[model samples]
Target: MDFNENFVLGCSAIGAGLAVIAGIGPGVGQGIAAGHGAAAVGRNPGARSEIMSTMLLGQAVAETTGLYGLLVAMLLLFVKPLVG
Candidate 1:
């Protein structure tokens, strides 16, 4: 391959790495949310169902960030938009 092709591939790899870093935020967020939810349930066992539902919903929402990051990384690594 030529220098330009190599450069594009290298940049794409770097971009995919950066994109994957986005997953960290969602993981931390979900952990914190789960911890708080557990604490909330412990404080009020009568509300366990409510707390669990809310926690699960929030976790599902938070998970989207990681999913988006994965999608971007896959696209960057496999699609190679800059190559063609």
Candidate 2:
């Protein structure tokens, strides 16, 4: 490949790496949320509905960062700048 093409490919790889880094927040947050949910369930089995709802909500919020990373990765792979 030409120098420019190689550079663009390198940048795309770098972009993917950077985007994946964003996943850390969501991963940690999701883990925390899961732990809380499990604790809550263990503490009060009767509140399972509430605990589950809250857990799902928190998990959904936490997932946004990872989704953003996925979006960036998809953009890098499919919408590359060098296609022209």
Candidate 3:
């Protein structure tokens, strides 16, 4: 490969790595929410609906950062700027 191609590939690899770094935040946050939901359910058998709703909302918020990472990786993988 040309020197320029090598540079681009290196940058793309870095970009992909950077994008995936967001995964850590969401993973930890979602795990926290799940743990809390499980504890709440265990403590109160009649509040499953409320606990599930809260868990879903928290998980959805956590998912946003991960989605951004996925978008960046997709762009790097399939949306090259050059045509030739």
Predicted model with the maximum TM-score: 2
Poorest stretch of ten by lDDT in candidate 3 = 75-84
lDDT value, residue 8 of candidate 3: 85
Clashing pairs in 1: none
Candidate 3 clashing pairs, residues 3+ apart or interchain: none
Over 4 Å off in model 1, which ranges? 1-3
Better of 1 and 2 by TM-score: 2
TM-score of each: 0.84, 0.85, 0.82
Error of 3 at 38 (Å): 0.6
lDDT of each: 0.94, 0.87, 0.85
Off by over 4 Å in 3: 1-3, 82-84
- Per-residue lDDT of 1-84 in model 2, one digit per residue for the tens? 556677888789788888888889998999999998999999999999999998999899879989999898888877886544
Q: Who is ahead in lDDT, 1 or 3?
A: 1
Candidate 2 TM-score versus the reference: 0.85
* lDDT by residue (tens digit), candidate 3, 7-60: 787788778889888898899989999998999999997999999998999899
Looking at model 3, residue 15 earns an lDDT score of 83
